[model samples]
Target: MSGTVIATHGLRKAYGAVRAVDGIDLDVRAGDIYGFLGANGSGKTTTVRMLLGLVLPTAGTVEVLGRPIPKAAREVLPRVGALIEGPAAYGHLSGTANLSLLDAAGPGGSRRTRKARIAEVLEQVGLGGVGKRAVRGYSLGMRQRLGLAGALLRRPDLLVLDEPTNGLDPQGIHEIRLLLLDLHRTGTTIFVSSHLLAEIEQLATRVGVLDRGRMVLQDDLATLTAPTGATVVTTTDPAQAARVLGDRVLTSDGERLVVRGSDPAEVNTALVGAGVPVTGLVLQRPTLEEVVLAAATGSGDRVAA
Candidate 1:
């Protein structure tokens, strides 16, 4: 966990002529809650599967926890916990019983440690009081929490979750977000995949955007959501302001000037000095959703500093 917790070089996965995951490279740092974001069918889940050795890459290399993947999956996977797709549990079984079964079936599991581990995880997920409740009676959010608890049983250094909040309501989503934040504060490196830009914006330290099996962007959330060189300036005399601003002016409707990539101070000074009375000016900062949309659609030239 000193360097990259997950790294991929030229990763590819194809079926017949369809490439679900094209050649892509990734570097997920230790302790980072890296969001693997994309639209539906953008290969986010495929990428996570490759990392967990659940799906074999058609070509290229993968390393997880500093060890080569698939080849070292046996040695590496135990240290990495995952909750892919959704909760895999029996509806008829009690919450405690389900966790016990899954853990016992996994490698290194033993009857001696199973009970304590189950109780510990149930409490960690806020399900301690309902440990004996049937899974069929649990809400979707509760089930999600239970799934997360199972993944945490190993106390893995890396936790990989695919669309963790797929169908949750607002409250459920909020609960999951809080849980993820708590885990992150405790120093778990989380690699979560989701199609919702807003969801990722809330929790990811860094983001990797995918589109149609190809990676379009990867950077810090701050870097990706910075100002995009757009500004709005209002003046008493719009015609005069437009003439003074010249080509830097993107648009004007005889009242305000929509300028591109110019400082507000400079714009005000130029307008006032040119005999145009400046009324108001504001610099526009692009939102995370805007940036994600631009990148996902391949319309963005670069992220503004």
Candidate 2:
């Protein structure tokens, strides 16, 4: 009933004295590729589990697709698909057979077209031909694809994926990214929990960064990575360009200069007019990784003496 497909406030999860997820709010808008970012031990998995009602929160609330979790899990979860951590299946069963069993247990899928749906999803995830292969014989990447096929079996409106590309090779990862983008184009709201900054940087419209069980930053990716009023100029004559720019120059390497100006066009004009050879000029923007690192503390996976 709200604009946000996933909304949380003060969401917390604790294991005895250890607070796995300290109070954090997550806002995932409809039609957003919301990238949930965190270092290891940052509680991203815990938060994701809570979002799906797999783990109970010690405090706060989680609403997915406008419904409260656990209380409304039966109704809500059917419309939501999730792949948490990785996936599991009967090693003895073929991928298709495994999906058949999973599909039968769920309520939303119609038994009449279950086989057809399974086949469709298998194809969607690049496992169509291998659906008949025993899961034990499938490679890790194939298993991952089969798991994704399972998640998309019912065509849920919201996809909550945790490291969806885990164990995938470069090609497999690229294919999955394309698939996710295609899904997003068709109106599925995606909440991706991943540590792969490069993938997230390419896919996410909004990003939330977590560090040591706390949310350090949450904003539109564009806002977080916006230009910092600086222009980067690459020139064969860096010294001459810097001289022409004067105090506007921030830093200079052998061939590139960081200028204290937001408009690269203006800088380019000045350089060109001053007879300085400008090879390239562009606005300097912080990358998604830079913004995330600036927000979050050091990785929690580290143990220092």
Candidate 3:
């Protein structure tokens, strides 16, 4: 088996004449909380479906859990659990009943072991006492938790969740965040897809960015969030400062200049020597949103949606 729990090469999928997922590659290691990020219609869903063997790829090789996908999905899937798009549960059934049904259908295990596993997962996902309530009566967050518990019924080594935090209130989101952290600590590899940059920033150790059916960027969260040198903003003549700074200037935000690749001392030396006023100089660190947008657009422009 390779070091990566999930690996893909030249992965491609098309719907009719439109290429939903272009040739792409990915490597996700065990115990990683890899975030799949993209805007609406950016092919994130398609890519995930292909990975899970739900959608056949037109081209490329895919491997999950050390087995070739689709052909090996039946054997490999037993060790994988997924909650795609949203939670799946019988609305009329109580949470505990729903879990029981899933547990019965999952891979072979002793009856007592299965029951204990179900109970443990229920508690892990924060649905302990509420398991007796009908799924329809549960709140959106509770439903999400129940679905997660069902996925855990098989004791899967890998968990794939899509927009798991959608429709969750702030407190619910916090709860899920903590739950995921705990799961990661226990050596479960989590693969999550989300459009919410803030949520991904908080939970993901690494990120894969998709745009218009192409992967624009993939990197560790720390590198993506690190300061790209100093962004010195000044209240001097912007045009002249920009010319002096040349390619080092990132942009001008109304009466202030955003310079990159230059430290404060270098920026000040150039500005003061050029006879530019030193009214104000402030350094700014780039946010995750900024980093994602820059990579997606191939420019420093603000992202739409």
Question: How much is the lDDT of residue 42 in candidate 3?
Answer: 82
Each model's lDDT? 0.85, 0.90, 0.83
- Write down the TM-score of every candidate: 0.82, 0.95, 0.81
Which digits, one per residue and each the tens of the lDDT, describe model 3 over residues 33-106?
99999988888888889999999999999999889999998788888888877788899999988888877776
TM-score ranking from best to worst? 2, 1, 3
- Please give the lDDT score for candidate 3: 0.83
lDDT of 2: 0.90
RMSD of 2: 2.1
| lDDT (Cα, 0-100) at 118 in candidate 3 | 78
Tens digits of per-residue lDDT for model 2, 1-305: 23989989999998999989989999999999999998767799999999988899999999888889868999899888889998899999999999999999988989999999999999999988889989999988998998899899889899999999999999999999999999999888999999899999999999998887888899999999899999999999988988899999899989989999898888888999999998888899999988877665344442211
After the best TM-score superposition of candidate 3, give how far the Cα of residue 15 lies from its true spot, in angstroms: 1.3
Better of 2 and 3 by lDDT: 2
Which stretches of model 1 miss by more than 4 angstroms? 108-116, 229-283, 299-305
Q: Report RMSD for candidate 3.
A: 4.7
**Clash count in backbone of candidate 2:** 0
Each model's backbone clash number: 0, 0, 0
TM-score of 3: 0.81
